[model samples]
Target: MNQNVQQAAAPGLGIEVSSKVPMHWYNLNADFPEPMPPALDPATDEPVRPADLEPLFAKSLIAQEFSSERYIEIPQPVREVYSLWRPSPLRRAVRLERALGTGARIYYKYEGVSPCGSHKPNSSVPQAYFNKIEGIERLTTETGAGQWGASLAFACALFGMGSETWQVRSSYEQKPYRRLQMGVYGSQCHPSPSELTESGRRLRGQFPDTTGSLGMAISEAVEVAAKDPRTHYALGSVLNHVMIHQSVIGLELLDQLEEAGEEQADVVFACAGGGSNAAGMMFPLLGQNLRGGSTTRLVAVEPAACPSMTEGEYRYDFGDVAGMTPKLMMYTLGADFVPPAIHAGGLRYHGMSPMVSHAVHLGLIDPIAVDQERSFEAGVAFARTEGIIPAPESTHAIAGALDHVTSGAARPGEVVVIGVSGSGVLDLAAYDGRF
Candidate 1:
């Protein structure tokens, strides 16, 4: 490796951005005991071909989807964009530790400092750049809590491209500022179940009074992209390429923990919304557990209202409610399941990521479901102590971490890391009613 690459990949250099981010993104597909099941053709029930996916994704990303290669190099352009928040701060939550009256050391990787106020930009920028190079003029995507929509909006603006997003109905209503944030970044945002796409129309007909889910929004987004030759679909989570882009979170986090003079974390917590950020934060640590035999525990926390991990069936299911996309093998609570209203609208998806589901099947992550009240309690506690209000989705992780800490899953003096994935600045409405 070159001196620059070595320094960038070195452990204990967490305080500053690596002069250069690591060249390659890690892919777990090649390392799994058996290959992850392929996305199947909805019509033929056969594995989808690369060309079949070309209609929706950039050619380069389609290659990354099923790649068995251990590492795929991050494009220089993407790395340059990531430089803006490449090394997000990892702080020891000393006050929260004292407040909990626990002897366990608490540390959190704060991704809220990013321009988009979340880890979504870590992938969105790259997706936009790849599409920009591929001559795509417009991108369509779905979002739940507006984080992904805002992130993609910012990315498209930076790349001089047009962006369209269909946000879940519940989130759109609960977080109007998030939709406005997308508009601020020069993107059009619509509530899912709007009269824009066939899937949305069908959903309105089927359940006139129901709030939309991510699956429904995804179908709407995909419908528009499939019809427009110049538009390619972008997904914020649940896809392999997105996970690859998000690995930057875990990579920097490992270095940060090492630099903090904490050699290991006994347990790590991240909220699982289609499992993007959590998988991103835990993938590298999972490798250590599998290959290097590390003892750290990985946890995936989800809202009880949409507990795809803890209660869903592990089976082949469509990513969208309309079943427009290829069928993936993952933990799913049925595409037709309409989750109850919850503040963490982002976690109201019907299925988890196929890769993450495989890990859970292989016993890599412990999935837990928490209620809104418990998550809010934790979020309030975290905000009061840490001075940064966490998004409702992130509070699931806080609840999970505290559950582990109090239940004695993590012993005294043991290190614990929680993935504080986003800032809830745009979600103050969800907090106001509670407080």
Candidate 2:
């Protein structure tokens, strides 16, 4: 057995933990079949340089955003924080498989054990550390489902920095517990389109009764950072560096699977919002495939209500509603598009990550859309069998995995992994009144 791995005491339980955490984060940028499209300055329509992003992001993050290296060393400080919840458990979904009577084996990499109850902290910690070392006093960010806001708030608290977040209006009204969590972490939170910034006011004037979207929230947060020299914008997802920070998920999975005596997963299912969770779970394996090592199918499950990967057009689009941010080539449903207030608030973005979009465009990753009702059904079913209630966003992956198995697409004896990005403890309201 690898020194990093520890098998479960009970054999049939199939739960395994890693004694070690990955010291380096994997980057798919070096192995991408084609270079991803560069972010362009909205004003000049030319490629954005590191200096162009200096106003919004930390210098270290900007280097990562544009880095071509295959692996980057994880700072010891960041790694120390990660050790709190790194090497999260990987378990065989024996009950779930028996419930479905599927021949294929089922496994789930659970990331809810973090202090923030989600995978958002995987990047938030590093983002906070990087900004703190550079003398940044505060961080401004946007969140759709409140997970990112709470995670950033926790990270800022650890690094002794102030955090201000604008959450989507729908989620602000629906998920109050997440807001409370952020407040407990000593961060200020607001509903998007509030009268906080010029962008927010303009959006409110244009759509007075709008429920708000991630794009609008990003504009509000970015506006604040752009105007303040001591503050920097921290994005939860849809950025290259965020994706890289999240790669720890897959790196750990690679070792856990091998230590458990599994060769390779036949397919991996992960929910795609800004694509951070999916990228974190699949990027390492996809890198292997790029190097002609594995044939694992990386599946990105998105909401049918906001199907950026399946229905949106691939093109250069603004990352925010107000056009204050750079434009990147990706699958976009138009920055102005406001999706329905589905329970999966995080997946309601108008655009996918440029890196994920590039993989979709090249056929490296498979994209599928799941309806909200079906997703909730899957969540409820899994809770009954697995005894863990998945977050509304994570239900999309469960629904997708069930869809694949039920559709007879998965071969017998194949191993399938699901990325459970977070827990639904604070999201009980979404499950209220639903079966």
What are the lDDT figures for the candidates, one per model?
0.87, 0.92
| Clash pairs detected, candidate 2 | none
Question: Candidate 1 lDDT, tens digit per residue, 297-377?
Answer: 999999998989899999999999898999999999998887876778778889999999999998888898888898998
RMSD of each: 5.6, 6.6
Tens digits of lDDT, candidate 2, 15-88: 33334878888899999978998999999999999999999999999999999999999887777678778888
For model 2 the TM-score comes to 0.95
When summed lDDT is taken over every stretch of 10 residues in candidate 1, the lowest stretch is 8-17
Global Cα lDDT for candidate 1:
0.87
Query: What local lDDT does model 1 show for residue 137?
Result: 92
